[model samples]
Target: MVAEEAEVLVVGAGLAGLRCAGVVAAAGRDVRVWEAGDEVGGRIRTDVVDGFRCDRGFQVLNPAYPELARSVDIANLRLQHFGAGVGVRREDDAVILAHPLRRPTRVPGMLAKRAVRPSDVVALVRWAYPALRPSALTANTGGDTTLLAALDDAGLRGELRRVVDRFLAGVLLDDGGSTSNAFALLLVRMFALGVPALPAAGMQALPRQLAGRLGDRVSTTRRVVEVSRDSAGWRVTAEDGAVARARHVVVATDTRAAAALAGTDPVPTHGVVTDWWASDREWPGPPMLFVDGRSGSRGPVVNTAVISAAAPTYAPAGRHLVQASALWGPGRPEPAETQMRAHAAEILGVDAGGWQPVIRHVVRDALPAQPPPLRTRRPNRAGAGLWVCGDHRDTASIQGALVSGRRTGAAVLRALG
Candidate 1:
């Protein structure tokens, strides 16, 4: 086959790749993207099964993300926002701890449930105050510590602790609270500022929207296996033997793939297994993510949500869609279908006996682990001709991926000039 020539070639069609290509193309540079997967969006994919839309992994798009708002057309996504709160499942009942300001009417009911203590509430405010300021993370002035330590230091040990810890674990996919305190606080700040939502179509819509802007520049089913320096610039070869020669190359794949192609060390990643179910009955509770708050209840599921309640388009007209997410760890395996169903039922306070299994997605590298002393930006320029960018290169989030991509694209442009 004749070798394809590209002025700039980007490997992987995830958010980073699409964003980088967009930047380069916007600058009037010839850029092309090759995605190994059958579709764009990388891990942010959705599968249609029996008329239900099941995202590869449970994910939400936060409009508060600066890069997201700047890059994508948020209105087009048709976002269905979740309630600004979390449902904590206790031994006997489930209580929703909503934002006092956003859901003022619910606050009286929440306080009546005694779901949170005044002291715990005070501690939470103190711990989250610094995170609310974007300057804190930008300047990296405050000393960092583990999330657990920070919470302890703030004296947040109460029912609120259990609820918040599990809720965050589901979001970060880190059950042990080993994530950076600063990072966790930043996430909390986002939650405070914006309500995350699912697109009317699904989470994959975000990347699809990005890829659509590139027109024919994005190519899927092109699993890149090699990237080596050549006289002109670099050569990218796919497993199918197709070759692309470019003046600049960007490794914009996942952490392991990017590290392998860029000759850099791979960062640790956290995995998650999400089970999707379709039930004829709907959950009566408000559309919010639920976490186990019952003391010492060590079930496989970290969080469960009535996805259809939040986004009706995800399910058929009469059916409801539910998602149960569990962390994938060392020696930990996917739970049996029955166990997941039972736990989800318990969490939702509904009968899941008849709920039909739709799909179970096991993503081994769902997220690059973010540890303490948070470093938002990692080295992106790997060599003279090769560069790297991903969520791993910046913060581990949609925001990070877009920022890294734009930064890498600018670097490539500068190199070519």
Candidate 2:
């Protein structure tokens, strides 16, 4: 049949695509977003089952996310901050890293109680350098360079591998090997900007708000089959034989999808598994915990969060919710659910026997595994009238996705002008 026409055709209704559509439409341009799933948010999805609200994966927002805080109205959304310092659980020891906001008197006690070795604390302080300086941290090459190389020297490597890497792996879900040293610096920048924030309702609320703001410009359940250029502009064919033509098009899906639509082959993307537990305990609140699970018996379990305490609406009153995640190496066998429960129980200091986790989510292609001096990132513009945007294009995170979308949108706008 005939193809629909618009000034801009955005594929993927995730945060990036929706954001692009919103910005373009707000600028008085005709923009339409095509979403493959029946829902709007891509990976950032939430489900309500049996009076419980659960996100596909536990996600948090750093107040420092430039795109979200600056472009989107986050204040209107329900948000809660994790207290300053993150809590850590290693074997029998449980400790809380106090945020700088704590009273000076309490800071020492908290650190001491948490059993934070003086050297570990010192290493943490040193690592905070790049984060404190916005200009230095955001430098284009800052994220691409290796942290090890930047701090190449004696003692530092030992400290990083022993203390810093362990802690970071617990938080970021991947060892520093899969990410850039700049990525760590960015987290520090986020902490320096403001505490990590979570939506009171659920993670999906953020994307839903963005989609709602876009009005009738979004089309859900429209899977994009192909993206190619024609003499007039760009032609985007959906799975159902429907076509959309636009002067500009943005592919904002995940990396695999983006590659497929652009007629490129798929590359290896490291996978990770996340488990969410909801029960009767009180969630300890945000600054959620990040344990250095590298030393644990079960293998590398990084980046665990106590989400319910971070936000009130995640669970029913008096009930707590916790999300524990771990990244598996390529070709590694998936861990059994029983094993995950045991690990969670040991980490959280609770008897997980009766506390059933309602949700289990596994992202086989969570994010790309980029080594230091990260490579494999594609450009935003694939052709004259077509563009690409997603977390995979740069750093891997919600903020990265938003920034990529904004950048692609700006580029498309400029090209049109």
Report lDDT (CA) for all predictions. Answer: 0.89, 0.70
Which residue pairs in candidate 1 collide?
A: none
| lDDT, candidate 1, 42-159, per-residue tens | 8899999989999998999888898888889999999999989898888888887886534557655766667777777778778877875867766773588889999999999868
Which segments of model 1 are wrong by more than 4 Å? 100-109
Q: What's the lDDT for residue 416 in model 2?
A: 76
Query: Which number leads on TM-score?
Result: 1
Clashing pairs in 2: 82-286, 82-287, 85-99, 170-303
Tell me the deviation in Å of residue 214 in model 2: 1.5
Provide the clash count, candidate 1: 0
